[model samples]
Target: MSTPAPHAAPLVLVTGASGYIGGRLVPALLDAGFRVRAMARHADRLQDRPWRDRVEVVEADVQDPASLEAALDGVDVAYYLIHAMGGGRSFADRDRQGARSFADASARAGVGRIVYLGGIHPDGEELSTHMASRKEVGDILLAGAVPAVVLRAAVILGSGSASFEIMRHLAERLPVMIAPQWLRNRIQPIAVRDVLHYLVGAARLDGAPNRTFDVGGPDVLTFAELLQAYARAAGLPQRRILTVPVLTPRLASHWIGLVTPVPTGIARPLVESLIHESVAAEADLRALIPAPEGGLTSVDRAIELALARVRELDVATAWHSATPAGAPSSPLPEDPEWSGGIVRGDERQRPVDASPETLWAVLEGIGGRRGWYSWRLGWISRGLMDRLVGGPGLRRGRRHPDKLAVGDALDWWRVERLERGRLLRLRAEMRVPGQAWLELGVQEADDGGSILHQRAIYHPHGLLGDLYWWAVWPFHEIVFGGMQRNIARAAEAAPPDSRRAVNTDTDTDTDTEETA
Candidate 1:
């Protein structure tokens, strides 16, 4: 196969690349061989994005006319995806100002074309402030000398996206819904992926300047119908949605905020936009992009994809643990300037028929160069991840080969206290939802075998913390049990003198194992 020649695909400037819609569009541009200049208020916020490294980052605010000059410099095509839906009260004015500034900048910069995404509403209907703002932005972009293509869409459904989050919250929490008149209002929700396809396609189009197209999925269901469909997709019982014409948009916004994870400020605009049907009127978007590309995703599929994306982010990302005792409890553990909460007195124990020397050796060599004995790979992998997120990795070995001191770094934990061959207490330095600790203590038993006790404890933060704790409980059970068993085995494998002599002045032995 002959490799295609890399022609100049145009330097495209994507505003709001740090936002939900714009965030997903950047990678598509990169994949299509376009030179991209990503614009965002805080470039660092977009650091974790997949296309972060593939484009030039320009720090610019759309509302600032001066900022737009530098942002539009050397840009052939610009995507105006910025929307201020989160800010309070005057968000509509802010949106208009930003759009106007960008339009002026694009014209002055002599940009060939501008592609914008706006909200769609049925023509001839009274529009809400949110919808009006969207229309105003489109109008502003159109006024620019450069040809601008506006693709107006409605209620984008994708995980982490606002509408999808609202749907998720409502479906997940409310079994029976008492909807307002707006609930019966029909809408054409677009899949985020489909929306991106159109945006990417519009970027490369040759003709048509100052044209606006309505964009949406094939499904043109009412708000209530969509809710039912989403509920069904989630495997929940068919929820009854009773629509009452008496409830107004203002009340709907408050109700939505109470039900969904979205704040009232965001939900208010979204509910207001629902006053009119948002089905696509023009089929030009589909004509520009064909079949598979043009095809509108099913609401169920869109909902599933959105939910899956949120899950992936949640599971993969780790929130840093809070500090304890005026000391930073982070795995790095250098400064004691702790910023998180403190945990104390959470403990458990077990006993083994082994001497203090043997037990201590087992504990010190527990991880790193020494395998965890069983499920060791799992432990190491998690430890590495912790280290990557500024937590301690397995690189930090124990202080003494077989002996531990107070405040010695061991893998991802610190030895808080050690009493010769008798007891060893460790405070977890790894970042977790809550504080964690591991304590091992040995004592001489009456039966000539030493008692070895090992236990792990955790304190959860809030609702998320509780969920996190339960979700990982199964893994914890396996790892903690394996760790306890290995310690006993390591002690048994050691020489008889070591097992018999505890500090050489100790005698007797017995065994006990307990966990919580």
Candidate 2:
């Protein structure tokens, strides 16, 4: 495929390519006929995307100023989507640093414009750490040397999205929920599809507006109403929600952690963010992005889409880790930390007729939305066990559908290495008595086919870790082997021409039912 002319569809650069919004944004841009260059700290995180080969993936970290120059070079419009919400308490600082550095870099690269998705809130209301950091990022980007466009929204509802999952898990699991009083606070929830539309439309916007716009759906509902609406759509009975005035955000966060798949770090900020009204400040965004044909989504309709993705497992492609994004910017560690410890593992390889790119896509998108490709019930069971023990769990899904980059959280794994068409490795994050790693790869075979390799490495911490490994070894044959074989078959079965087309005509997420 050839690049679009500068005047046609600007060579769009999406930062945070391994993130939820960034992951979904890429396909939207491609379908809209824009040539895209996606930047993430680790390009390997993006390897499994169906459209993996459709766009250029560059390994660059916004926190590292020196790396931005090359990634920003020749970019017509840069989407400043990187934020530190997943980065924890110090996220504000990290977000500020990243945004300032990115803005400065975009200016230096002679980039024509920048677009950022920011947070929305009522004025005069003290914001939470998450909202404050999000707003600051937008502030920095808006002041960029080049013209910038900031689109702000509240409670983005999508299948795998953090905000959506919070209410979703709560509604599904609790027949009666004792939640924070903030659930009563009003909010304007927008569908992920509409958010993408605004973002894509921003590319074709003429001239430098260098301004901020608030965007949201037509309906304004409180958090409780949103939850109730979701319950109705999912066919669940009306849930009883008892709002306790005494539960602070911190308590609510811990309560959420115990009940939902969301971790404490992510839940706290999210809960705190709900303390105030978040209706869009203006309706003028319709002029710029233009409303879609049927108009904005209702909470019920958005809930259906979100729930559908959850059911289909496409939620992983649309979400990211709840852990703070403090993992070193490197995607895959070249070597283990190297402590004197005993290790055990499973290793195997197979060959496939598809191209290396096809196989790599299969390996890249193994977890999160697409699932393990086999024995998913076991995977979900393990993830639940991990969450019970305070591990990262499967809930912290990958950021993008097909992209795997360094630091991205997979179900109980963190993308450790992505060598493009050659290798993809994951470090296990689930609570185990030992440190575990799973590696998958594809390379050219002599006869023109490709070799696929799979391995599970575990370094036992003690007798318990040793026992844990032994207990799980028998299941690896069924889980790991099945996953490998399924991936090969899926890759081979896929049409070479299937990925060439980007379906931007309508935005949708079709996921399977998530394991409880």
In model 2, the runs with Cα more than 4 Å from the true position are: 1-8, 313-316, 321-324, 328-390, 394-410, 415-424, 431-435, 439-516
The TM-scores, one per candidate, come to: 0.61, 0.75
- Runs in model 1 with CA error above 4 Å? 1-6, 312-516
Error of 2 at 344 (Å): 8.5
Error of 1 at 35 (Å): 0.9
Best by TM-score: 2
Indicate the worst ten consecutive residues by lDDT in candidate 2. 501-510
Global Cα lDDT for candidate 1: 0.67
For model 1, residues 2-43, the per-residue Cα lDDT tens digits are 122357668889987755567667888888788899987655
Compared with the true structure, model 2 gives a TM-score of: 0.75
